[model samples]
Target: MIKTKRLLLRRVRKEDWKAIQRIWKDETVSPYAQYDNIKELDDLSVTNRIARWGREAEYYNHIFFAVCLQDEIIGYISCNRCVDAYEIGYCFHSKYHGQGYAKESVLGVIAYLLIKIQMEKIFILMVEYLNYSLDGRGKCMKIEHVAMYVNDMEKARDFFVKYLDGKSNDGYHNVKTDFRSYFISFDDGARLEIMNKPDMADDEKALNRTGLIHIAFSVGSKERVDELTHSLSADGFEVVSGPRTTGDGYYESCIIAIEGNQIEITI
Candidate 1:
């Protein structure tokens, strides 16, 4: 059982359904929560699915948690085991509007994962259609940029610096090259490099899929891997599969999310 000053998080018990239904029924909650407006609010189907889903998660170490205010249930948070990391999801009740509850709740869960469970990496699967014009930006989760391949070096260089890199017409690379390149980096040290070279094509294959495929988290080692797996389960992160070793000599796992992205855990 996890408790905030005004909220409690635990596995959904039989009695939680009533509060769950009530929370979902709030008119102010449905838009952001993505409920159907025309339908009479009934989460019997959802609760039923979640209950079974939680059970199935045990085999893979996946877990689910419900947020309650004293006895009134408000929302839920979920984390799933993926190839060496935790993937997160959250939602809340409509009645608790205008409070920083959602942000608080998410941060709380993440802190629990990083500090308590000792998870090194976390992935949040964001799909385009599933996006909410959130804050008017791309809402791509603090992404610096998504760079694709380009051809024709000299011409592309001028175009890139002129438009993307915020550069002027006069620019020169440290070394002259006929190949084109793109760089995407996070505020943190995370970075991705793409260059138009024959050998580089294979390297890009790891990340550049035409469609949304998978998001992964990197962990320290196999021991840390199992520790995180068990720790996340204790905190209610669902594990879909593994602590299994992949062909590359790394241990990995997976979990599913609402917007249809796979959370891959690997070391």
Candidate 2:
């Protein structure tokens, strides 16, 4: 069993078949049906159903979990193993609709996979993907194989090109996202993620988190660090600290942005 502060991921049992079937049967659900009205799992014996899944789960390639919220099962989240990663799939019961429970549950799922399953990479592959571009720019970010949200498709497209197109400096990227904005990624695998919060608003709220944190970028040498900082500052991205060595042997500086996100340069 993989348990988080608010949820648990455990094996599906005979008792869960009905709830699982019921959730799948809902017409309101996307990806529509597990089986058509004619072949609906109405007649499948519970033992047979369990036997079907039990053998498969034992294979270690697929782990089917009944997502339990507050000790009560309401949905299912599963990971299907691929060549070098796991694809996560989840479905929630409409009965628990609008609770933000899905997000929390998925968070738990990631932690579970990272900690227990030790999955190197996990991707969300939605059947009918959705994305939220609250930025009003109508742009959507083609993120790590996740659902597409309801937003202006054009703006979302432009958003990816302008900000989220996976470019980064020294393995880091900071960009505006929907609502609060987002941090983009680079090809080498270092990633950044943030909400739709703009630099101004995020900066203000970030200081409230009470601890100091900043994005650190490494340059080739102290002189190059100085040159880059001077050029970037001239270009209007606030340059904070730098050319100074930390007690631990790295040279660095912090630049405060209107959003309070830091641009740290180091050598």
Best by lDDT: 2
lDDT of 2: 0.56
Q: Using TM-score as the measure, which candidate wins?
A: 1
Tens digits of per-residue lDDT for model 2, 54-155: 545544456678888776778887776664677887778777767876787788878877887788898995443233422356444333422222123334
Model 1's alpha-carbon lDDT is 0.55
Model 1 misplaced stretches (Cα beyond 4 Å): 24-29, 35-44, 54-60, 125-245, 248-267
Give me candidate 1's TM-score against the actual structure.
0.43
lDDT of 1 at 26: 62
Q: How many residue pairs clash in model 1? A: 13
* Superposition error at 53 for model 1 (Å): 4.0
Kindly give the stretch of ten consecutive residues in candidate 1 with the minimal lDDT sum.
163-172
lDDT of 2 at 125: 56
Model 2 ranges off by over 4 Å: 27-39, 45-47, 127-267
